[model samples]
Target: MGHVFGAFTVLVCALFGVVITANGITVDVNDEVSIKSAARIVADGLMNYYHGNESGRIPGVFDGGYYWWESGAAWGSMLDYWFFTGDDTYVEVAKEGMLFQVGTDWDYMPKNQTLSLGNDDQGFWGITAMMAAERNFTNPSSDEPQWLALAQAVFNSIALVWDSQYCSGGVRWQKFVFNNGYDYKNSISNGVLFQLGARLQRYTKNETYGYWAEKVWDWESTIGLIDNTTSYVYDGGSIETNCQVLNKIQWTYNMAVYMAGAAYMYNYTESDTWKTRLDNLINTLDVFLYGNTNVLYEPACEPSASCNVDQQSFKAYISRWMGATIQLAPYTYNTLFPMLTTSALAAIRTCNGGLDGVTCGYTWLTGTYDGKYGLGEQMAALEVLQSQLIPYTVAPYTNDTGGTSIGNPNAGTGVLGSQTSSATSQTKDKAGAWIITCVLSAIAILTSIWMAMDGKGEAKKLQEWIRVESNYA
Candidate 1:
């Protein structure tokens, strides 16, 4: 009887264990599919931007023409696509788009240049161009020198305008003070310079680039242009506060550029401080920017403001930054995956909201509903999905046994089970033991019943003995 009971207990435990393992595996498969779907959405967007013939000249409702900042963001999308796909086709498209910005002359003179060279605009455009140029330079083709020269010319031209006073702390939007010098010391301006400096350092292997990047980073932090308080950084300084104000609120791009630059700087210098900074930034973004909500509101922004309260802008930025961060720090796969996955899913929701070619609420000044599907928004969504999906696409996870089992228990797998597998396994084991114990108790109760049927005195003795043994055990 004892042998039979022991065998039954072991069998039940093992079966229950297998059931728990199977449930976990089912959950993992679901999560992986969700992640893959999210990645696909992002990839589709990227493909659309590269191949879609959407005209770039649509007038924004608030702003009169296509924003140069938006154009720069488009470049970011292309870069993301290239990084994730490792497909030269996306890279080629990115180069062409950047060169188009440089125009036919490729000179810094701004001849026939219709695009705004406002300090902030120039910084954004130049930095993106520099990045494209650096990327092109690494694998020089016929167009490499042209791209480099064009990028350098624009960068130097912007640098030439710096007087170390008005544009002193960093780059201002323009020479004129707009909205109480709010235009001065813009976060985007500093962010771009930070990007440029980091890229330049990598391409040139010169410490000067690092120096400039660090200087801009310091300025951004000290001036509070980037939100110092939030785990995620804000868009730019408030026009009124000279202190960082979250007016247009928290844009994903703002944090993305900061993280991308920080990650790059860490890579270049192998600095733990930068790595920590990058990790914290990513962590904050993942927590705040995700969930079922389609809109991301800047907690600091006045709820009343029309221009600053746009949720699509927030979505746009989130996708942008996630893609960039992934590109910059591929090794931080665990950190980057959730961000990309969540942002991609959110972006899909944004698209479903009929945001296509609709002016985002953030473009308050541009009231006209310019065809809403701009390159920046589209590209951001695409880059995230494409980059994440590429790995799975190139090499499908063939070890996919339908049988439930623990996957590799590692913190960096970026899968949920990877983080909690051990704890979950121990919990299941404990739960199985309790179940087995309960079954044994049931058996004891039945045994006592049988004894009672045979004789009352004997039943009482058997019950007491069973209780004593069970309690001791």
Candidate 2:
């Protein structure tokens, strides 16, 4: 494949007082040079856990307890890194990892990941693909899947599975019925779809994508996942209860995705409603920001020391999407800069762990290393620090602009299954269908029980494995 390289100046500045070496990273949000220097060190810390480029390792996989899904997110952060800092150091590996994981169908639903794959999981890769297209990242070869097409394929595939039968309308957490969280209708899944649709609409100038974006926003509002008046987004609800029993635990990424989506809508339509929604969503983020400090934190799990591996990384998306929001909604800079810079400063303080003394910890409010480090910690710190370049960079590209990625509107058409018709059902067939449903329900029940007993524990096992792998590496 042909590659494009951007000239990057990775400078190590020892400017007196302008840059302070906090632990192992430079601390100076005021100087772009200092910010990029800090970001480079943090990015290096992040890559320390990545073994994807090794001969025996999977091209896109990370070395730690990171899952197939978060690997995509990690690469997305690298894309952001390259975009923000003009550092092409990781783009070749990023492209390889991203391309290697877009399964034969080109939708990111690689068969190897089918067991644990959730709608949100596939959505993360699609989000990354969309970012590549928007950022005008180095394109793939003629035979490879184009970034826009990959994202569109994911959108179409997930759109086919949008379950109107449950809770009136919402996507399930897991794509397959056999998966553990299939009965849950989560905001992250729907929010991702909304964000993807909004971004595609802006890039393609397509109303169909915009329509889906609107539909998701409306459904989330009607189902009480999003309180439109306050713009407060809750986690999700169980479909078995018809989505009534809500999990009110709010995470930063949930709000970030939807806010970025709304900002895209506002930018595309230049309408008052979307602008108000975007502003309200931004205002509602006070829930994640620490009291008057403007520093970000995970309220649901950070304070209690209970955040799992996945939850530990949620704040990165907040910084990631907020930076994107500034491009689409330029007026938000003054309101958002303080929040981002404040959080970045606090987050860098946690980068005093690991042998290199720059590996970041999870909790930023601690003002010192909390001894935690992984893909989550490093990626979180990289994003918060590199996002300082938001004001210094150009806005993302669209087809009308300089975006070079080729897209297929009907990308996932081949994967869309035909809807079963009730009119053609026979009495015997109906009986058989009922029996099948009953058996599947029993299996689902058993799966739920097993998950309750052991599913989440798999994360711990994976984490331990990753620790061992990193140690050996």
Candidate 3:
């Protein structure tokens, strides 16, 4: 049976000739069997990056350049894989990894992750929890933290820190004051918050989540981070500059997160405002789609080969969110399905890398492997490939519509206590010492500021340096 189906897939691909790659995986856009076959191959390559299932390794994590937050994102992709294909292979590992990281507070703010945790980082994990709930994946035991509660916890925790002191109101890139880019208010942080809130609203029929989602949209638009005219979402800006100067780097993930948020809002309310926002966002996505080919590309860093560890896996979010948007707002299928098909075809063609012959690459427009491989590249291809199966899958579930995850409206309302791990406790102790050091350093810097101000040229140069340093995306 396997040989017969494989041969038939080859014949269909040859006859349709929609897309072909050097790798063993090939897909005929019109054939579900072909897409799933190719997706399974790509999924194998994606999982090759995972070592979290091994003894002594952290659950839900990938080794090498992958950060803590990306592990969460990867599991989210795996959940989509399970939802789309009915595959149970990865479910146990993903569930263990996620449950292990929910922290003492039942939120995703594990003490070890706190040193580098950004609102965006925690938000990614929350998004994954929401996906699990929507997919009706295996539920936790009665005492274990539920998926809906975890999502709500993340939302509540992040929502408390919405800084009104700068950028009017937007979540900072980093959750802690000590982290780099703490002064930056980036789109991904706020976008994730918005997307999470939107999902929560749909799931629980909670208007408070809906209200916060609207507030984020209004602030993003008013601050011009989301361009009202072109509908292009910029990377972010510094609160130090009062967010007056934008970084202006157009990242695919930023747009994709917001697109999902707007789609969910529209789906829940059926209002024209959300409907219009969704339409404009989709219409403007052509910017990331390389010219007439419509294959997704990272505009800021792909051409220059400067994409950082985080930027590399950005397409995974885009592909995943695009699938979510299609399900949320079914009207979008006509406009987005062709783009997804074209992009998926191009994406898999770049998977002919590594000894396994299915390792993927970052740039899909090249139509060949770029020799650059990571969790991001493999995930990007896997998402686009498996997302082709979304149309045949059931729509995401809601509380009233068969969702079973339990909720705790106050899950994230209080301070996060330390977990019982000795390693986590030691890390918190180190963090406390660092905070004191930062205070002393701030005092010393303030003393130098007066001396520098005495010389006009020196003060002007200092201002320029600060502006440039804080402008990072």
Candidate 4:
């Protein structure tokens, strides 16, 4: 048959769109029910990965599970699931990850990963803890070593890596490792820092947090990692290249992470600069990562053999980051929500309902089942589905203009901050530029008119003088 049926499509034919089975749930793409079901499947799948495993660490399908960053990503994703749904089923997984990753001191110094724990690796754990701190736990606060304190410790540890050395002030990709990609300083390492700094500033109102946020933001501009006009963020550079060379690999996660960081900082400071940067980055992201159909396409990977294992999980971050961006910058609702919803629907449409749970495929564009079934792919799918269910809340406005910078979270409007688009913000920016242009043009025209009139008046005076001289003669 020319019409090859997906798992949902086949089930829809028999049941007329009504079923939520343990094997898998099938609902229309737009239905929020789909989001809930997907979240359950993803959480269950994560359990499957760790069920009998002693390490309690998720293995990376693309690389080694012991890779600290990927493990950190899994932890962060779990925490996100908790925050997104306010569910505690995910809390144990997240808690285990937080405690397991810490060194004997309960800090981020992993003994086995000391040589490998670069800025980005540690930053991922910090990101997870940051979320946990925000939730404060819906269940009893029984988790050891308080959430906020743990995040603060990791943030302090990461601060030690900042260098005035190469790339003009970013932590290297590797710390002690020599010539083993240690010379490079990538965006993920710094982008996570920017995110952590912005969020900390939002929560604590500490000036130092704002300072770190801006520092990383400025550093990217100085090093040309971000294109001034195009707003495209490139891969990092090696020391041998003098930080002058850049790898033009534009991964979806890089842009997503930076946009998310910018969005959070914008919300934290309400700075026009951060707002401008966030708008620019979002526009640029649309240019490179999203297709006209409103689905995400890894520009570098999709046209060929598909993304690698490292890249397999990249879209998950992008999806979750965009979800966070929508929460942080209500201005991005128009541009981001449609893309996210459409992409989620496309992603959900690809799930192959079988005994292994609703395993999703990697190719979102075709909605065709991606043959390579890995933990990364499932994690990626779960993230997008979870993103669809949660409605981001904006901090409630306070009458105290001079009050602390931290807005009151408990007093939220709960308005599902998902309407006004970033394009509106851009329009306002353009309006200001337009007003200046109009004023300048009017000034130039008036000056030209005055000059012409002056020239004519001088000529008439000369004529009058000539007439007077002739009469005298």
Q: Estimate each model's TM-score.
A: 0.56, 0.84, 0.85, 0.74
| Candidate 1 C-alpha lDDT tens digits along 233-336 | 64444333444443334545567777878877876787887887778777666444312222232333313232221233444555555555555566777766
Ranking by TM-score: 3, 2, 4, 1
Q: Per-residue lDDT of 1-473 in model 2, one digit per residue for the tens?
A: 00001000011121222344557677777878888878889888888888889988889988778888889899889999998888899989899989999998888999999989999999999999999999999999877888987887788777767766568887888887667677778999998899998998888776677888999999999999998678899888776578887777688999999999999999999999999999999998789976655778888777767777887788889999998898899999999877787777777767887788888888777665787778888888889888888878988888778887877665664623222211232332234334433443454565456646754344212233234323322
Model 3 ranges with Cα > 4 A deviation: 1-16, 19-21, 415-473
Ten contiguous residues minimizing lDDT sum, candidate 1: 20-29
Supply every candidate's count of residue pairs whose N, Cα or C atoms clash at under 3 angstroms.
17, 0, 0, 2
Deviating ranges (above 4 Å) for candidate 2: 1-20, 415-473
Error of 1 at 333 (Å): 2.7
- For model 2 the TM-score comes to 0.84
Candidate 4 at residue 277, lDDT? 95
TM-score winner, 2 or 3:
3
TM-score-better candidate, 3 vs 4: 3
lDDT over C-alpha atoms for residue 12 of model 4: 40
Model 2, CA-based lDDT: 0.79
Which of the numbered candidates is closest to the native, going by highest TM-score?
A: 3
How close to the true structure is residue 289 of candidate 4, measured as C-alpha lDDT?
Answer: 38
Q: Any idea how many clashes model 3 has?
A: 0
Candidate 4 wrongly placed segments (more than 4 Å): 1-23, 29-31, 52-66, 138-143, 287-290, 353-357, 392-473
lDDT (C-alpha, whole model) for all candidates: 0.45, 0.79, 0.79, 0.61
lDDT of 4 at 402: 18
